[model samples]
Target: MRGTALGAGVLFAGGLGGGWALYTKLSDNITADDAAAAELARYERERPTALVRGAQNILVIGSDTRAGDGNRRYGKDSGTERSDTTILLHLAADRRSATAVSLPRDLMVHVPGCLQSDGHRGEPSFTLFNSAFEVGGSACTVRTVEKLTDIRVDHYVVVDFSGFKDMIDAIDGVQVCLKKPIDDKAAKLRLPAGRVTLDGEQALGYVRARKSLGDGSDTGRMDRQQRFLGALVSKVQSSDVLLNPAKLYPLLDAATSALTTDPELASLRGLYQLVRGVRAIPTEHVQFLTVPREPYVYDSNRDQLVAGRADALFSLLRADRPVTVTKKNTSPGDSASPAFHGNTAAEDSCT
Candidate 1:
């Protein structure tokens, strides 16, 4: 999701006057996931149909692969990776609002059979949601998400750790207010309490640091990630960045270089069209929330959907209906209410 916003920033910079050569270079940076598209084409009949004509649902995946150049510091390259973070972004038909729903990697869900890298079809199984990525990469992850939520996915984007860090550096830094100090050696982060600005490396650790933070649960990490993203979006939309071409150029480069998307969004023009629709959406209209879930019945570490609540949230998104969310937590069994626990981009994290 952060990559999507940063990529859109490129269009604004390009329009200012980089000429054809620079535009070509930036556009070429985006990798087209033709393999995933081909795999998805095989299951077109099984995929859900798009309900709203102008609405869009994009799956933004943060890949935790340690094989890359700058990523070796995180861990050893095990020749495999999973979806470290996954968010389903829904843009309203009117383009007045957007909702980002985070899906926990530990959530237990039914994964549909998918074609594996070994050139064989793997049998369907019930397992951790992130397992889909480990088995078949983006194609399998998309199929699993589609199966989990009946909403159609129009496109998908994969971003990596190095790219994420580069984007933060490009934007200077994102400001965050911490109530307590943090010193997570595992995440390579050490920061004092209160308001502070985080560089690319620190921002990565801030969002990824689980054990040294509140509750030490993925849920807490997800909430912190949402808040940090909101802060990033707010910073990008500020006049200081948008009004300056020098600032926009680095952001443009970092964003395009970071993404791997489906064929439709693999080019500058396609991404431009997407940005044009969403660039004007007000900050207050941007909502962020996690899917309703509870600890898995069989295992305390795993998660399961909160029965009727999860289905209700999915239903609203499928129809492109408005989803209202509050900051306060709601009962897991409360399905009659329309509002869920969440926060908007307009809210100040420091407050």
Candidate 2:
């Protein structure tokens, strides 16, 4: 999930060796500079104290907003933002492992009052987790997440549709495999079953398409997205993007353009330091999973976290322990999400 930022940071660290003159391609760009500055300027009140030194937590948000030309073409410019996807990325102090936990957007929670555009706080209410984004942007969402997980979010990165597409193209493409053919007009995606390489547009379609791809459930869609991110991690690790500036510049541009980070991580040096810690971690140590959840007891349309399991998972992260996810074998009729199902970047689509 955070592989984009991690990869960019690790690559930039090496680029820095060539001197500041070489990085003018990134620092001089107005869009990236302004966006970085905006993230630096966001104000926050409550933040959790780190339990482990050198360990870092970042919230990666996939904003479903039609604010840019590249994104407007895909959806209506509703003038409001929502988080389509959110992942909590944890980097261990030893830098030997990374854990990414996906929070369901439909999960119901209490949204606290947030600072509004008018400079006053809005009223608090109970709503879906994603609603926090619409109510007060990223900070509200962070607050909601903090309330839910009891963990401090050290930083956050928000990326929109176009930014995601651009990043995919910058890296050439991510490889994926399908068990069956897909043709979803609503998602603007079409592909035959088998091994395939998807470019920017196609990759976006693949990740966003749910109706014709899986069981037509958000959980299924999230699983697919996680797999795609796993593939992306592999691509970055194996490719020469880090060693080649020609390839690195476009990635930096695409990543920075779409990113909204916290003040501390808004600069190139700060980003580099955050990413450097995870560069040496083996791909197998990077895991992706969701907090255990089920249909809300009161509303079938919404989701409720499975308390015991969810708490256990959060506790592990809080204590800086590696989460253990056992791969479960599912029968053909099983559609239930596994208790702990996740794949490492070392495992490709075919795996």
Candidate 3:
């Protein structure tokens, strides 16, 4: 319900940008519309898999790049940017349900060799999962994920800091809950414990603030980000944002402006079709969960996917089956594996 436009661009913009596909056609030369259409056509040619019974796997990468306006304030672009956030979004074949699996950046994984943006290719190696993004942008990241999960990714969308901030401001603000006071200088966030509505800048800081938030852990920060996203979805779907062209236009422009996508997903037509399918699912059917993982045995700072559990989760997605997330503790002394967990689109923001 809340993400139809911006939940990695597949969730919230379901009804708003449907008109984009009518504007252009694919051609050999790369014009604004031409470039996008050609890109999508190229992807169609190179991808190894066909559509799976109507199911779609979209990789949404939230890049923490300081290359654009309002973003450079964060820091200078030191050449390449790491994926600040990554979600493997799975839309069910029937368009009746959607599941977004968050992949932790700190996880240790095999980064396959890939062609870089600069026309050079890098070799595969064992490194942080986010390193794939740094080495070859989204393609490399997608390759690594496919190799790791054995599930084909149909499309991808990369959004930078400025875009995320602009979208929030376009929508007014998003509501969030804070259990205690927080003042993180590094993230530029300062807030008191309570329910509050956050504007663009504050929302970014809220999601990015780690040192001053719960347990000072990435997992805790991710939970907050998930809840904030849930609230944003609620705001968009419940309001007349999609129906009101005046309000929808800015939101659409902000979202589209911030995205770098796969060829097929690069055009308005491709995205319109995607949104149409996603809109068929009710918010209650959409679910969110993190990939099951634990600290690497050799290094507590880095993470390694829990072999059996991780494979089971990936397999369910590969088969387009419903993922069962129980609220029961299956491990001892592991806060990461909570006894009660997981969130769906229908969750109350206050909870």
By TM-score, the best candidate is 1
lDDT for predicted candidate 2 compared with the true structure:
0.76
- Per-residue CA lDDT of model 2 for 217-299, tens digit only, reads 88888888888888888777764766566666777777766676666666566666677667777888888888888999999
lDDT of 1: 0.86
Which of 2 and 3 is ahead in lDDT? 2
The numbered model that scores best in lDDT is 1
Output the lDDT of residue 56, model 3: 86
Model 2 — TM-score against the truth? 0.88
Off by over 4 Å in 1: 1-18, 329-334
What is candidate 3's lDDT per residue for 97-133, written digit by digit as tens?
8888888889999987776667776887999999988
TM-score of each: 0.95, 0.88, 0.84
- C-alpha lDDT of residue 248 in model 2: 66
- Candidate 1: C-alpha RMSD to true structure equals 1.9
Residue range with the least summed lDDT across 10 consecutive positions in model 1:
1-10
Supply the TM-score for candidate 3.
0.84
